[model samples]
Target: MNGVVQNDAWREEYNTLKEQYTELKRLKEEVKKLEKSCFTSSQKQLKKLSTIKKQLSKGTSGQEVTAKEVTEVEESLKKIRETLPQPNNLFLRSIVGSINVTIPNSEDKLVYKERYENFKRNVTIVICILSLLAIWIRGYTRLPEFILQFVSAWFYLALTVREQILIRNGSKISTWWVLHHYFSIAIAGIFLIWPEGECYRNFQMQFLYFTLTISGIMYLQFIYQKGQLYKLRTLGRAHQMDFVQDAGMRSRSMGDLYFLVPFLLYTYVFQLANSYRLYNMYYMQECQTLWQVPILGVLFFIVALGNTWTLALVLVRKYNS
Candidate 1:
């Protein structure tokens, strides 16, 4: 009797293990089927998205659509997007109906969208505060120049955060932005070490250094942006995109001649200023304040004239268009 009872217990244990194996196999098959279905659905959605993009591109411009038509399209696309199996598909959804989707082709679209909207709201608040501070700095408060520098540094730091977001969202880095980033850091460093209660003469020298540094950095940035534009045009041609080279191909006129001449003058002046400063530093000699004064004056005049001409040209083009 004891032997028979032991046999029955062993048999029951084997049966329980067999049942668990069967259930495991069933679950594995179900998962595979679900995965296959998901892939099929995703492919279908992608095709639909491509179709919509093509249709929108064919239209005159997204803005040309009637308000009612836009509303209808948006609602229909929103419904289809809502039915998608995964939230990662939101990037496709955004392109279907929106005209100016800035955060394109990002994998984490939802997270990025939320962050971008919050950033815009914060910028608006900061701008208002800065406006108030500017008024205060000019009127009620007689803050030291260093204090003004500190405030400017902080304001630029806030702007940097926004730029970082743009970089993460795959926007091409502009030369201007790259220089601005480094220049902001350099200015912040200068302010941190700047002596307290310095004489007005000393302050003026420091301010001049700051101005020269900023001008040099910005000039480099302009050159970089121009180069990037050229490269982009070349790329567009290689890709056979319907790119209009109207603006790129137009030969700059005599009105614009003054613009290029000044940039060349400024570059020369910047190099001269750097050389003079280095010479004075190395020789332990007092540098004359007027050494680069003439060059600076010329730069100022050229910048003003170039800016006026550029503005007039832009206005005329816009009005004509």
Candidate 2:
């Protein structure tokens, strides 16, 4: 009778364990059902996902409509973007639409600041790297010079062309940008006709040194500009999506002038050194290479003045404000 009682107790324990296991499995199934109903567990993300889905279903293109899928998607995205509250930015349209869709342009800045930023970043990197490589490599023909000229021409064309994508997209940078790069093209052009001599060889290394400075400054500028853009983006003060400054933007720009002062001084000092060297090499030393000596001197002076004037103007603007 005692053995029988022990067997019955063991069976009851087994039954309790089985029931508990089944209950756990049932709870898991219920959870899966809830997840299936919601599609996403996070409630915060649901609104955005639902908005997109609704837009696709009932947007510019009718839901059952099979044609113009690209246009439909572009239109839906534009409409959704329009729903967001944005500042009064009428510089350029930042919203780049699909190739097929006619962009619904407002007097807004470029299609997207992010895209323009990426574009400029990529271009700056490629041109600088290739230009540096071209200058470093020794060649019999004007191939290296040609490469440098090609880079200059490409940038100049991109910057100077009327209705270029960047300008149209409302890139409101300084006027000195136009002047500096334009002069760069002219300088590179002079290199094409330059003859090989001791002066030529010496000038090449120095010019490379100067190019290194230019590249370094540009890299630093790119980083600083991106940082500024990030701050504006966080504050939502950016023009459309581009870096359009307002009165509020000056808070950081003014505070940072101290940092820029050093960069400006370095630039002027380097250009002055270059000017002195050119003057000594050409006039004092009696070098007859017009392309490398006198003309270069004149161009270097112009660059220094142009660059200095620009920085001075920026400083005055910041201080006066």
- Candidate 1, residues 209-266, lDDT tens digits: the string is 4444444444344444344445655666321111111222222343433444455445
lDDT of 1: 0.46
Q: Least lDDT summed over 10 consecutive residues: which range in candidate 1?
A: 238-247
Predictions in order: lDDT? 0.46, 0.59
lDDT of 2 at 133: 77
Cα lDDT tens digits for candidate 2, 82-119? 43322322321333332212122543335444554555
Against the true structure, what is every candidate's RMSD?
17.5, 16.9
The best candidate by lDDT is 2
Q: Which segments of candidate 2 are over 4 A away from where they belong?
A: 1-116, 131-145, 162-165, 241-253, 284-286
